[model samples]
Target: MLNMRTKAVWGLLALALSAGSVQAAEPEVTDARLSLLPGDSPGAGYFNITNTSDEPLTLVGAESAAFHMTEMHVSTTENDMARMESVEKVDVAPGESFAFAPKGYHLMFMHRAEPLEQGDEVDVLLHFENQPELPVTFTVVAPGSM
Candidate 1:
């Protein structure tokens, strides 16, 4: 027979386990790639971010050892001229996926430490507002490969 205190502790343990399971189902990144441009030019990165939890997820920033700075950018066309702008954060709804592709939302890697070659792999750490920092590997590909 379990005492009242023992029973309460067991109940709390069960609740903690349930909460852990819920946290495990969060946002994730997949199909990540970085474009390799010629010379010392800046490159773009593309990926798909999926939200699996019940609430929305916001991607705040990103960092990489290969570049001096990483920023989220979106391309827009005004009067037939395409331009890119930096964004502070990207919001993703539950059960939805955000695409970072060409002519759309993407990551701008600025001031690279060294020029990235084809088939090179780079590690990028993605920061979120409500979740832990996600470590992602981006494969370097030729320009315009998408």
Candidate 2:
């Protein structure tokens, strides 16, 4: 009986340790939307990513079936001129949030793979370093809305 109790206690301790090592929560994405341009022009995507995990994560890029190419970019005004440059990655610390808004860090979706219109929904997969790809749905909106 003593040996059996000891084994049970050890088993419970292992189980507790495993649970503690598990990630508490996955990252949360909110306010996902896309600014769809008219005709065959490229569009832009915006959203907010909240890092709920215990460690920092890097957002590398994004992919979507609606677009053939997707890249991370940042828009800035330099010397009275607007400039848009490609960004390699963005880091979000634990318990922090990152925004992909207008004139800020955003996803540049180019080369449409399919037809899209306003009010349509598209699936986008956000790639991260050292973490699983996060799936987000973006609603198409007018370019002027944004």
Candidate 3:
């Protein structure tokens, strides 16, 4: 049988190894961006993210030079009123995607530079809780459009 001290040492080693494996299991997101929404002072983004590893990923915030502030917001109709709410995190399943589109799931931009117009491109950076600083280019679209 192992001594008490030896058992404790083995337990510590196992814990350290487990932690390392978890840290190495994060997935990577590619080609992600915020889509331009129709209206004023706010917009959203759409992107494709692939979770390559075992660990899950969450998108918590975003940043852009064109806007004063960026947040991950969700749209839901409650009591005949269409309202938007902030999301704490967006979880991406392993080998899956989390898309952000208008009128459903999207990024809300505070105090935009100007009214959004089609064919305009801007730089936006997405922040995930697990993987932060994923920057990409964004394009504006016309109203009553996708």
TM-score of each: 0.88, 0.90, 0.68
Candidate 1: the clashing residue pairs are none
Clashing residue pairs in candidate 3 are 34-45, 35-44, 35-45, 35-46
lDDT of 2: 0.93
Question: What is candidate 1's lDDT per residue for 1-146, written digit by digit as tens?
Answer: 56988999999999999988765465778999999788878889999999988888999999999999999999999999999999999999999999999999999998989767989999999999978998999999998677
lDDT string, candidate 3, 1-146, tens digits: 46988999999999999988764454454444445556654666665666776767777777888888888788888899999888887888777876676567777777886555777877887777756466677766643556
Candidate 2 similarity to native, TM-score = 0.90
Best prediction by lDDT: 2
In Å, residue 131's CA in model 3 sits off its true spot by: 2.3
Question: After TM-score superposition, what is the CA distance of residue 60 in candidate 1 from its true location, in Å?
Answer: 0.9
Where is model 2 more than 4 Å wrong at Cα? 1-5, 12-17
C-alpha lDDT of all candidate models, in order: 0.91, 0.93, 0.70
Best by TM-score: 2
Q: Between 1 and 2, whose TM-score is larger?
A: 2
